[model samples]
Target: MEIPAPRRTRIQQEKRELILEAALEVFSTNGFRGSTIDQIAEAAGMSKPNLLYYFRRKEDIHETLMQRLLDTWLAPLRELDDIGDPLTELRSYIRRKLE
Candidate 1:
């Protein structure tokens, strides 16, 4: 049987998002190879140890960010349908992507 992930409290979820946003800024500016956990923690305004409570490694943060971006980028494509008018569907897809 598969183990389910632990559920997070509202504050925990908010902290995770904060970390992700900070990581994005760090990674974009420093690149993944140049970025450090200390940098990300500082950007997030949390201690390195506290950041570790949310993510064990820089790779984990990068992977999570990439996965979220990929999911968002593909969502509009997934909504496209042959049954829908092609022009209208294309316009809708463009709008979603822009947003």
Candidate 2:
């Protein structure tokens, strides 16, 4: 049987978000290969061990960020209609993405 994930308290959830944001900033400037857990933890204003308590590895942080980005980035495209005029649909899709 599969075990369920534990529920996080509000603070824990917030800390996780903080780590993800910090990771995103570091990865954006340094690229994933150049970024490190120390950098992300420092950016998040937390210690490396503390950050590790939330995400065990830099790869975990990157994967979470990419997954969130993909969900958000692809949502607008998924909304595009096959029935609408091609030009209008494209314009609407672009507008949704820009917004």
Candidate 3:
């Protein structure tokens, strides 16, 4: 009988998330103008080629991360509607901003 390969566990997913988080931190701190793939790979504790595997290019990683951040930021704002009580809505907006 052939053995099947094991699927990734939650820990593996969490590690990937950690690597992405590290990449975002490094990118934000250095800015696109000053950052390099080597820097990100170092920050992520992965080799440059490994980082490239996760993200094809520096710009690709930056764009993907930035888009995810924008989507998250927009989600709460999109929930806001003009139909709600003004004060309550404003309060919720403030809370979301804080979040």
Between the candidate structures 1 and 2, which one is better when assessed by TM-score? 1
* Alpha-carbon TM-score of each model against the true structure: 0.87, 0.83, 0.69
10 residues in a row with least lDDT, candidate 2: 76-85
Candidate 3 per-residue lDDT over residues 47-86, each given as its tens digit: 8887775677888878878899899888887878789998
lDDT of 2 by residue, 12-93 (tens): 9999999999999999999999999999999999999999999999999999999998999999988988888999999998
Could you give me the TM-score of model 3 versus the true structure? 0.69
Error (Å) of candidate 2 at residue 17 is: 1.2
Per-prediction backbone clash count: 0, 0, 0
Return whichever of 1 and 3 wins on lDDT.
Answer: 1
Question: Which numbered prediction scores highest in TM-score against the true structure?
Answer: 1
Task: Return whichever of 2 and 3 wins on lDDT.
Answer: 2
Q: What is the lDDT of residue 93 in candidate 3?
A: 85
User: Which regions in candidate 3 have their CA more than 4 angstroms from the true location?
Assistant: 1-12, 85-88
Report model 1's TM-score to 2 decimal places: 0.87
Error of 1 at 87 (Å): 5.5
Q: How accurate locally, in lDDT, is each candidate?
A: 0.96, 0.95, 0.81
Top lDDT prediction, candidate number: 1
